[model samples]
Target: MSGPPTASEDAPIRVLLADDHDLVRTGFRAILGVEPGVEVVGEARDGDEAVQQAQRLEPDVVLMDVQMPGVDGLEATRRILGPSSPTSEVRVVILTTFDREDYLFEALQAGASGFLLKNASADDLVEAVRIAARGDALLSPEVTRRVIARFSTPGPAVQPRRPPELTDREFEVLVLLARGATNAEIAGELYLGETTVKTHVSRVLMKLGLRDRTQAVIYAYENGVVAPNGPSRDGSET
Candidate 1:
């Protein structure tokens, strides 16, 4: 199966800066200025403006600050990635000074592709935009473990529900994905082409009605498809 297509090299990744701080936006612009194959197409001072500009500019990625005057980043992200948005192709990466776990969970639920720290290096910022633009997630290995550990534990919210029927191959892919495996890694492990892995990923997202990879990971955990630190049939850690 062919995977979801990534961004092509022919066009630069257009980005929209959505932050309440003027200095933050300026700093982001300055940082992204030196990066090749990236362009800042617009800026927004609040979540409402962010949503409006997202529709108008149709940027490939949005650098959304978690805190804004009105609507806030979480709501803006939801609206931007929601079904009624002008384009569902756009991706958002949440930026925040606080590394609160709740913020990360909420951002993912709001359809954000990643969570980035405000103090992250310029290189990190540049790389994050590139990753998000390519329809890939930006979760770090540490964050991945944290997310799994947190979500895998039983809770009133973690009610078990049946997942959509997936083929055995697709189930394997989802388990590895929840375990933080990259497409390339999964390809090597499964002895399939990278494009085929992508296709499987796209199918998984489609069948699961998920927006992106991050949601798929959460779904796997919530649906009991995999457990925190559990071993799989193939002897792989979940």
Candidate 2:
């Protein structure tokens, strides 16, 4: 309930907590304990220790906080995920008090698999780790919209209102998909079968020349599909 596991779990997600405050880590541990899945593998007082623990513990997820003492969270993230010799894939999820758009972009650029506001619900933190562990980027709808609004190029990117190739349903699915909704969630929202939603997702990815949902989300954002302050979907609102 408090975090990912210190050791291996039946759920197979080991988690490490990195924050400057001991009380914050304890609170996170208490909150994460009630969850059926997830466990707290270890804790670190700063970014450097976080990186070292990440290497040693090799947790499936690292809940990292920004603005730490030496080495800072973003730099630590870069070190962990950068071209290095870590045997395990140490997925990092930036969890911070701030909700700055710059932090979001910088975290993503630093090889973070996910970014979560510190105010995120327990459910969201859990789901974000799960999604990132599954190799998908975890973007909140608000985060996604901000990525769009801050980076969109307008006419050149949307002159023709998107290519005529995508079907209406496909386009709708793409928008939702890019908004960070999982296939199951999107299916429920759209009243479609999971398999059908998967098909639409796949088609959108292929047609848009995207490598995966994360890139597709970035594409949609940078192309004006979603805007900052727009309605939030994808179970990722504040």
Highest-scoring model, TM-score: 1
lDDT of 2 by residue, 1-238 (tens): 0121232446656778999988878987787766667778899999899888988887888889988898888888888877554722577888865556677778776667677778888788778777766656666666665666655434444321453568878877877766568888899888999999978877776677553565666766656565434532232331
Residues 1-238 of candidate 1: C-alpha lDDT, one tens digit per residue: 2333356798888899999999999999999977889989999999999999989988889999987986899889889888666756688989976467787888888778887888999989999998898888887786688788787667764443445577889988988888889999999989999999999988888888786788888887877677687755445676
Identify the runs in model 2 with alpha carbons over 4 angstroms from their true place: 1-9, 83-88, 153-176, 179-193, 196-212, 219-238
Give the best candidate by lDDT.
1
Assess each prediction's global lDDT (C-alpha) against the native: 0.83, 0.71
Q: Pairs clashing in candidate 1?
A: 2-199, 3-198, 3-199
TM-score, predicted candidate 1 vs. hidden true structure: 0.87
Measured against the true structure, the TM-scores of the candidates, in listed sequence, are 0.87, 0.67
10 residues in a row with least lDDT, candidate 2: 1-10
Our model 1 lands, by Cα RMSD against the true structure, at 2.9
